[model samples]
Target: MEFIDLLLLFVTLFLAIIWFKYWSVTGGGQKNLPPGPPGWPIVGNLIQVVLQRRNFMYVVRDLRTKYGPIFTMQMGQRTLIIVTSSDLIHEALVQKGPIFASRPADSPTRLLFSVGKCAINSAEYGPLWRTLRRNFVTELINPARIRQCSWIREWAMDIHLKRLEKGALETGSVEVMSNCRLTICSVLICVCFGARISEARIKEIEAVLKDVMLMTAPKLPDFLPIFTPLFRKQLKEAKELRRKQMQCLVPLVRSRRVFVQGGRCEESNIGGDMEMVSPIGAAYIDSLFGLEPAGRGRLGEEELVTLCSEVINAGTDTSATTVEWALLHLVLDQNIQQKLYEEIVNSVGKKGSITEENVESMKYLGAVVKETFRRHPPSHFVLSHAATKETELGGYTIPAHANVEFYTAWLTEDPSLWKDPGEFWPERFLEGDGVGVDVTGAKGVKMMPFGVGRRICPAMTLGTLHVYLLLAKMVQAFKWVPIKDSPPDPTETFAFTVVMKTPLRAVILPR
Candidate 1:
């Protein structure tokens, strides 16, 4: 029996090699494809990636040096076209927006969480995507809605500052990232469900959502569906995680549904002191309840859960991560921190709590946030984009359905684009070439932290507001100093977002 099993394993390997060779010859035969390093059979560049033992971002950075601005890689059955420079990115994503507006087809695990691509980010460029994205933008994050939601930010900020003070007094040092995550998650939850949930419940939702994000990340079976049979355990685990996620979020959806339908929430005790249901500040779920996608009926229970999950997950981690990075830079550069604090104090008298209006007025604070985004983007790469159909980009035939990667981080760091691109100097935005730089990539693609063009993140405004409010208030409430015997390190690793290799630890003193 052992001999038979060995023979079977060998036969399977032989068959896979043959299949890989056949695909390599025929699948990548398209002429005028971008240049990349030679790949090994069966594994493509998977072995090279493994050998590097670095974050994929760094690996791609090195490859960019060798392959020029545009390149291609064969990862298993997938073809990835990586675009690194500003001009090519603008040419593809902005100049030819419609051609590159759609997302790649969802991995099976991603589809499970996205409810068959019904959510905003995963959905293709079509009526469904438009309906969902338009609803989010118009209903939840429009300028009027953002103004109305100031109370939520204020509430979350109060709790966040108190928590930071408590941690600082008790431990003499505090972990900034976790506190930031909790605060951002709390604000997002209120916006999503139209209620201020208890800290315990908020943490429960955050935990499950975090698990879902990790489990649904691209896996081996996602790239090589032929190997799906070997990943039974992983797929099963993903399903269980999705179940856990549904368990945490679906009840919130049902509660909101009741409120939207009956004009009163069944669970009055859902929030702390405030009522969970409010007609004045309608939540994202409220909008979802009313939405009818073209040809499709109102969103189903599973779709509602998925959309709400996307809202929280998308807004929470990226915003929190940016706050952490910004704080770390401030800690490293006391002069910059002091200048920003002075600006905040001058804008809103020292005794005054930092308000959104005050935040808008503080030029230095805006520059600091912009510089942080440029230095350490929330994610090194945007969500993968795919061509709607076969098209030409940068003089190469971008075959249909190939995964196109825009290395957004590389664009910000390109020396040609900025003076001293490596430095974390916010003043660069205040004067000289960096002045009036366009982040939207409309005028030109200098830098795009939140991405650009049609499919850019819908929550960009809200996300930036969260960062501005949190960073301003935190700095106003306390003085953050690096921990004794330890210094700030900006070395990054990719999690849900690109984050510090060592989480920021600091001592906080009440101002």
Candidate 2:
């Protein structure tokens, strides 16, 4: 058996080499294709990328120097087209939105994780995606819906402040991102499920989410599904991890469903006799039980569990990371921090209660948040999108079914677009060229931290508002001080999202 296994591996590599050589000599039928490095045949650029390990973003950015703004690379059998030019991104993702809207065909790993593309995050573009996204927007992230959830944020903020205070008292410093994730998870659970849960339960859910995030990180087998059998351990672990996720999620969904059906939730008293507070239209889980996409029937319990997980996972990490990045930049750049602090004081008055309304008037605060997003987007790459059909992009042909991506962090720092693009200057958005910059890129491609076009994040409004309110309150209540011996570092670690490689440790001095 061992010898047979080795023989199979040898045969696979031999075929890959022969195919690569043949394709190379033929130039892979290179008529109007975008130029790219002649990656090794068979495995293509996978080896080079894998060698870099975690710094995939840096590797791709370096490639732009040789291949220009638009380029192509082969990952196993997959053709990945990366666009760095905002103009080309706008043209493909916005102008030709429909043709490029669909997600790529799921790899075996993604199929297992998304449970056959049932979750909104991985669902193919069509009625199913539209229905899921619409339900999410109308019930959760919509302006009015977000306003309704203001109390939840306020309540969570109180808990967060208390934790910070206690931590500062017990130990001279606190890890902001860890506490930030806790606060975010708490708020998301309450708003998403309409029930407040205990710290123990939240940790359980976080542990499950952590597993999912780790398992879903880009793997070699995912790009080349032909080798999925070799990833049996990973695939099995994914199945078990998802099962664990469902164990945590299904009960919440089922309990909510029972409550909606005039049956009291069994776990209502598990935490604090907290009857599910979200009325029919106020909660995402409640809304899912009624949705009937164009041709598909209403969602099932499994789908509900996955979609709800999507909301919790997407909302918590992205929002928390943005705030984490913002605080780090503020600590490192004191001048920018003081300017924002003064703006907040002048607008809200010293010690005045800061509210969402106040956040709107604090233009400098908004600029700071925007700059943080530009400098360190929550995710360096937008969710991978696939071309639905062969199309012309940047005067070159993008083959159908090709995976497409945009390096948002790099685009924001494009030298041609911003003056002193490398500098972390909030003033660029204040009175300079970035003034009134529309992030959606409808008017132009300035910055796209939330992405743009048809597949733009439905939660953009809610996420941005969360960042503003959290940053304002944190800045208003306390002055953050770096640990005496260790200064904050801006190094990034990519999990599900890009977070500080080292959690920001700082002392919170009450203002």
Candidate 3:
């Protein structure tokens, strides 16, 4: 080889190396960032994540342990921040709530919730998301509204008890996870769409949602921007999903509840709370369908349509998973289960039924729920947040648009926060006057089940009540035990909402 050719080859290799480094640190200086496991050039964590054959939660948690609570993972050239620290988490998420509230475009929910219409989670931080979030809490999941839906608890519990009774008679075993999913989904479906979903129908939705969820599932797509066009797998799935979703959800959306006044039935209350309303009002849709001018916050008609599906997904998914996990723990741990059961029986037994108003007095029941949330958070990691401008956290510089992710699962189990973090004992929460832990150990940076600050999940209360009431009723009606040798393994499932690795199978022994 000629000397000139050798020199050219060296130059070419050097330029490629420099370009790669430049790509990784484009938005921020990438200096003094927290550490992460070294990865193959350009690909970083993506290969590890995909290769694990799907242990995303454990892999991420393991990384956090090696790299501390606040660390970074590189996907190709894109920088992904993984926060495990409560302190910096507060600084970034809670303290800087508004700035960090925005969720970047990703697969799945972009189609499911955003419907290509930017709803709360999909809509970037702006006036439109603000209006929508406000409307959701004020109208749908408000304290009074949740209270009014007390019948949901009775009806759903009734259906579930009947299911378990029949199942035990036939096989002496039942899958509690399926029951939990149906109960939680039915409650949300009833509350949001004002409809009761039978178990078979719920299974049908779950199957379709499973496909749509995979197609739309979030990964480090930001790493491969050029591949975005190809990644429309979910986008296409979203369109098909929107059709299936409409077949079920739309009819629920359209049918108006006949108002009974003085024993007379008439046109339903459309604008009032009595009518079934979309998260976004019907007037907004009429205007959009009519091709009226674009409304506030630079939003268009397409985004307007997406809001309904977003409500269904957001209102349903994590909450159902959460309810499932909590009941699993309560049932598998007979001691804890009976302790809570006793508390419920003592408080509401003579009342012949449970009521939302009386639930506040059942402090131990509340603690069991809190402990369940702490041990098994719905999302091990939260939606990625981008710094709007240069900010400092943990004595490190987080430059503008640098993607930051928070890991709540580790934070919840961190040694600094709790005693016996690994154990499923609910009594940890039962400390301090028996009301359990009121500190909310993972709210920001520490533990964020429903997320934090301004963009905190509006459905937090609704979800909490839904979970507690279901568990409360399940306990009140029957005694739960594992199905013979079944181990309700705490090992995790990789999905949109982290689920039990094994669907909990148990026997429902009636009290």
Candidate 4:
């Protein structure tokens, strides 16, 4: 078997070599196309990219500076198009959004079985994606639906409020960032899974899922299809991650969907009572379960289950990371905290009491959150998307299956659009400081915290409200202090989302 595998690998490599030579010779016609760092022969830059957390952002930025706005490199046989400048990013992602809106059809995707049912994250630009996107937009992330679930936001905030009081009285110090992340994780999990989940359970789940995610980091085998014979363990580990993920994810999804459509997500005194049900709308689980058997299209049971898991992983981590960053900023700038507290007090009173009715009244808190999101995007880039067809973009053809990435963090901080882009100033968004947030899609392409175009995040509004209301509640109730003489370190370590090299350690003091 080993001999046969090695023989097959060499045969595949021969074909790949011929195909790559053709591509390189044919691609040489692009006179105006951007340049990039010199890559090794055959190997290209596959090793650097597959190293997982190699800060593709900084590398791409450096390439843009050295080369031009748009650049290209080869990660194994996979052709990577990196757009660093905001102009190029906008031209590719927004102006030509329709063309660059799909995800690559690749071997790793097939191996992982993520072809369909992943919704907005990995869904192809088609009807099912459109329907699912619409369903989420109209029912789940809608303004009215978000308003209706104001209680859930409040409940999540109240947990932190209680913690703030305890932290203020006990230590005059707290890991506010950790607590914020935990609360957001809990809320988004409850919202997505339609089950009652605790912070302990989230941490437990994160512990295991963290290990599972480690195995699926973009492998060299993922790019160099011919080399996969030597990396069979990677293939097996990817499947195992999916299997383990399903072990935890599927049953919860099944149970919660049953509860949601049956209206059991809101039952009372059901804390530890496994027999009881709690109502929380037709949460994401119900949506997946409902779509599972309707096999009018390509989605199968396994694919549905996989997408259900994607729902949890995507919604939970990003929101939690954003909340962490927001709290970190709040702790770093006490004057901002004081201003936010005053706004919350003036709007919702001194207890930090907020309601569905009062949410819109806290305008300053909203601006502050919009600014925070501008500063720290949850993910360095939006999920990679692929163009479905050969299409023109930025005066060049984006060939079919070419992966496109949008750097929301970079776009939000672009100096051309933002005055003092690197500076953390909530006032930039206040009224007349040459900065204004166009969340309603009313202005130029300035900042896209929720992303822009068709694949924009559905829960952007609710997520924003959650960040504002929760942070306001915390700031109103407590004064925050970093553990050291200075503030939380701004240096970040990359994860699926950016994490502080040192988590913000602080003591919470009473107002």
Candidate 5:
């Protein structure tokens, strides 16, 4: 019976391929489409994705050799336009604007993860996105607001240092990624909810976020919607995870409500006061309460929970992963690390505690951060953007609703853009076109780790500051020496972000 089932599957797939070949040759809609590898019917590029067993960007990179920089691939019924050229990416994302600003329709997996397209990260580009993002900027990530939250950053940094010191004393080494995550989570939670949550509650929120990230990772069923029933258990888990996120988050919002109203409430079981967090004026949630999303009325509890979750999840993982990569790179090159440390020392002195303000003076550290971003962007591409209307990109027509992606990894490494693209040289950022490259791609895209145009990461400034501070402080606080007989290995893996496959284990002795 099993053999018969396998044979039937192969037969169906063979027939699908034959049908696809015939259809492509005869299909009227094929005209003006970007050239790409011919795909099987129904399954489309699903088989190729499965066989590649590598980052999707690399597969697109290989396709570019035969199909040029801008090509298309079909994933199940979905058409994906892959843009590898910086100029083309700018034309689509920046020049075209709203035509390419909207997100792809929620696949089953994205719906499960986002809890129905409420989060800023996944919300369709429009009035609601604009309102939420505007509030996010004005209340949270704006320069003035970030500076106002300096106390939260400082508070988290103190805890981070003590935690690392404890680990160094007790275990002689620490898993740096976990520590980085905790520090980032602490800051974000305070920023989102306007309170310092106890370590125990922070742990609970972190666990759920991690689980949801793991579960929502692109699954085969996500591409082949017809097979979604096979992933019923995963989908169920997503629902439960969303519920858990709401349970953990909503109460904090309520508690903040109580405090904002000047009415006393029972102390949280999590055991931290809003005062303990030093209340950075208005929280992200507080701003949401004041927003009137057009046609949607006031933001509700569910949207608030999801948006705040976006705050924690977005702020925590990507910043943590980047710092981890930054540290990994620093560990691999002692000279580079020392150079960064010396710059910090010259700017703030070895004994002086580095503040958020001090990061600007550390030029070499800034370069290191940019170099790290280029070497290991949090993800290869931004969340897939959808074409809202038919458009021409690089002289090829992108039909309305076609999913579009810009491969940042490929463009960042293109030989024409950078000399010796494979080398990890921060010096490149200090000279020539690499010097002071606007990551926003406002002046032409050299490296778009955060993306470009209206959909560019609003958290870019905040995330960059978090990374620069954490990295500089770590270097200032201790000498991150590799575990004896175990030098750091710079390997790559994809998870919530691009991570070191072999996690860095290192000891930190006071500098």
Candidate 6:
């Protein structure tokens, strides 16, 4: 029976390949598409990509060099338009924002986790996307809300410092990335659910979300639906993962709903003294509960779970990975570490704790954060973008079906844009051409660590603040030194985000 199933699958694949090859030949091809290496019928450069999957970004970098900044690659049934230059990225994502705003279709596994394209990141560019994105920004991560959440940051930092101190005492060194992940996840969980959860609970939720991220990463079936049946085992695993995810998050959503209802009743009973009866908690979920998209009612429990998961997953790994990269640089360069420590000292002046205001005043610290973002962006590519309609960009026809992605790491490292793109020099931001650069890409995209234009990550401000505060607290709390016989290596790997291939291990001495 197993042999029969395998034989049937091979026969189906062979026939599908023939049909795809014929369709490719007979289909109307768009003229003036960006030049790219010729690919085999049906597969179309996928073999090469798979052959070099481990260092995919490096492969893209070589292609950018060979084919110039704007080029194309056909990956299975998908047409990938790769843009590596800042000017071109700005042109497409900002100057022509609307045309390039919508996202490509989600994979089958992603659809299960995203609850059928209901999450903001996975939603199509339209009323639903706008409603969800606006609610997240205004309600949870706006400037005023961030100020209100300063206490949460402080609380997380205290726990983080204690853990690091304890680890150093017992083990003689601390693993930086895991601790950073824990701290960021704790802060985001509070912000998302408006509950001060136990540490064990936080770790549980974090582990589940981490599994979801790894499970939903791009796969062969994602690019080629015809191949999905061959991946039944993986698909079954994804469904189980989603069930586990709901098990972890749906209860929090229900609890928050009850809290909101109870508060409303109390406010009515007490002559509408809402402030006395209820305070702001679960800002993200609260906003979701109130949100009514066009034609659709308030989000259902599954949708709420998906959005809340998006919030936590989006903010946690990116910020934590960036903090790890920054700490690794500081550990490798003692002079840089000493300079940053001096800045923290001078700004706070032996204060017991580093305040948000203190972080604001430390210019050098800000420079280091910016430099870290440029050198080691959390992800090498932004979320895949799609054209709303057939459009022309940089004298090439962009078919509506093509998946447009910007190679952000290449843009930051382009020699023409910076003096020493290879060096981890924060001083570049203090002077030189890097001064006064805009990260939002509003003025021009010198380096887009967070991305740019209409579809930029909504939590950009919150994410940056996390990195800035955590890096400040970590540096001020200890003197970081490289572990003996295990010097820090900045080799890169693709995880949920771009992280150090070998996690940073450093000795932390209390200051």
lDDT of 1 by residue, 46-162 (tens): 778878887778889999999999998877677889999899999998999999998887677888888888988989889999999988989998888888778889888998998
Residue range 339-399, candidate 6, lDDT tens digits: 9999988877645578777787788888899999999988999989999988888888888
lDDT of 2 by residue, 1-511 (tens): 6999999999888768766664454235464678887787577888878887747788888998899989888877677888989889889888999998888877676677676788777888888888888778777876788787788899888888888989999999888888888888888887878877778888889778877877877787866776778889988888888889888877788667767787543325434434576555567777778888776687777777778777778878898898998898788877777787788899887688778788987888888888888878888788889887778999988777678878777777887888887777888888886888888888777788888888888888787887898888888888887888889988788877888888888878898
Candidate 1 colliding pairs: none
For residues 335-374, could you state the per-residue lDDT of candidate 5 as single tens digits? Answer: 9999998898899898897887799777888899998888
Off by over 4 Å in 6: 1-30, 264-278
- Report how far off residue 9 is in candidate 1 (Å): 9.7
> Cα RMSD (Å) per model?
2.5, 3.1, 5.6, 4.0, 3.7, 4.2
lDDT of 5 at 213: 75
Cand. 4 TM to true fold: 0.86
* Candidate 5 clashing pairs, residues 3+ apart or interchain: none
Among all windows of 10 consecutive residues in model 6, the one with the lowest summed lDDT is 268-277
Q: Write the per-residue lDDT of candidate 3 for residues 179-233, one digit (tens) a residue.
A: 7666666665555544454567666665664555565566555565545676677
Candidate 2, 216: how far from true, in Å? 1.3
The number of the candidate with the highest lDDT is: 1
- lDDT for position 82 in model 4: 71
Cα-based lDDT at residue 320, candidate 3: 68
Q: Give the local distance difference test score of model 3.
A: 0.64
lDDT of each: 0.85, 0.80, 0.64, 0.64, 0.81, 0.84
TM-score top scorer: 1
**Candidate 4 lDDT for residue 225:** 71
TM-score-better candidate, 4 vs 6: 6
